[model samples]
Target: MSVVNNLVDIRALAALVPDGAKLVVAKDESGVAMAATRELVRRGVRNLHLVTVPVSGLQADVLIGAGCVATVESSGITLSEFGTGPCFTRAIKAGSIRMKDATCPAIYAGLQAAQKGLPFMPLRGIIGSDLLKHRDDWRVIDNPFGTDDKIVAIAAIGPDVALFHAPLADRFGNVFIGRQRELMLLAHASRKTLVTVEQVVEGNLLDDDARSGATIPALYIEAIAHAPKGMWPLGYGDAYPIDAAWMRAYVQMARTAEGFESVVAQWLAGDGALKPLVGAGLGELAGAAA
Candidate 1:
């Protein structure tokens, strides 16, 4: 089958994200796609139902602070080593956004249900915790197969769009997510998947022996944007290390309302320099195995 070349400029990529869209993003420390995120903020995409698979860090926090997100769903939002996510906390405290607190496994199950086109997914965890108390969609049921065991059923999480960064992609649009398997679930579960890649390769990734298993085929992807150092300030599973000092400074700068605004100002300034300049070595991982 012929594949449409979905590769687009970063701004054009941002334009594809509709306002009030239900969006799912990759987890913290892996495939965060900060460059695409800043473009979304610059375009003022609003009222998003942002779902973070398992956990989040800078991506969720900055979006919330920029007034782009109206609701957030995730296990937790933190800056990891930098500390808590200040903007996410502030938005929750000020009642500016709706919050759906979920556990990691439950979030996975919800997306898995969507991936499999199932009404709900039966998960083993969160049955005895307070996490279930806040979620009306989750139900604890006795095993119907004659066992005395109980199971928790979580409703499917089907997002309007799924977004993430990947180490590399091919001309055919197949993305190399490596061992970050959650990205596969996200792409399958969402109605559309937008991707950013460090570089674009020549042949079909599925035909490459090393990348076939780690690849999310072109058919599932809606658009692709080229963005080197796209996961700056966050680790990319050894593509490059996280920028620790920059992240620490960000933590301090984002601690207050005014400070956080300044952080955005500096990043979104200079027309388009918000994209980080670090990590020029991503090309080294272009054709290599994960």
Candidate 2:
């Protein structure tokens, strides 16, 4: 999988995601995730799983209403608090799609087990929690070498697709994530991957700085979209600032399923509803239209 440098279009990137596929989104407030989610819903994808480090701003509300079975890595937040009143929240409480903390070795081992094509991995934690109640997928087996009572075996999560946004990419799809390594592991573990980059540069930007080229090479990349300001709402460090007003409006509009669909439609129609701020590279398009 040496797909480090290549450039492709958004449509090409979106095409890789099939209907009814289970998608895992690396949680970020970035417009890239927002746009990717909108596209997934627009394409009739029903099972969407969102994975984020214990923090908000991934727009859980939108995914839940779209019928996506959302999952979040536990970060000291109680199930009751996390499950609140959102649609996906309720679904989680109702047991439609399971939720657990990957920060724990048990959960991380489970994902690793799946990535390695193993059936399960032995875990010492989660002995008395309700996580064991749903043991249909997990099994408690005795440690052959030890006198311990039992260890929980967690299953792997190999998602159907993964989408992420990077700071720079070449026309051939070589991505440079800069400092935001955000969920780079889960993105690589997925069967297919889509990347939306700020600008498509030529040659190897990684040659100048190896620290910047932390993620997958171009071979693993399915497609690269030249989407400037795609990381809106999530600041790209020195690249740009978060758009607070736009993020607030986006969250409100995507609160309903219908509104979510409409937003995607507007985006596809080139109405510039989700377009980046002026002077951020998209200003030329705005000016040409005017």
The best candidate by TM-score is: 1
Q: Model 2 misses residue 160 by how many Å?
A: 2.0
**Each candidate's root-mean-square deviation in Å?**
7.6, 7.2
lDDT of 1 by residue, 1-290 (tens): 45568999888888898999999998865588888998999899999999998888999999999999998999999987789998998899999999999988888999999999998999886767988888888999887885888999899999999999988898888899888888999999999999999998887899988899999998899999999888775767767787777687678767777666666766665323222223323332221212
Report the CA-based lDDT of candidate 2 relative to the real structure. Answer: 0.57
Compute the lDDT for candidate 1: 0.85
**Model 2 lDDT-worst window of ten:** 76-85
Residue 265's lDDT in candidate 2: 49
Per-residue lDDT for 71 in model 2?
51
lDDT measured at residue 103 in model 1 versus the true structure, 0 to 100? 89
Note the residue pairs that clash in candidate 1. Answer: none
Which tens-of-lDDT digit does each residue in 120-234 have in candidate 2?
7777777777756744656788888879678777777666776777777765456776656644654556787788877777666556566445745666677777877676545
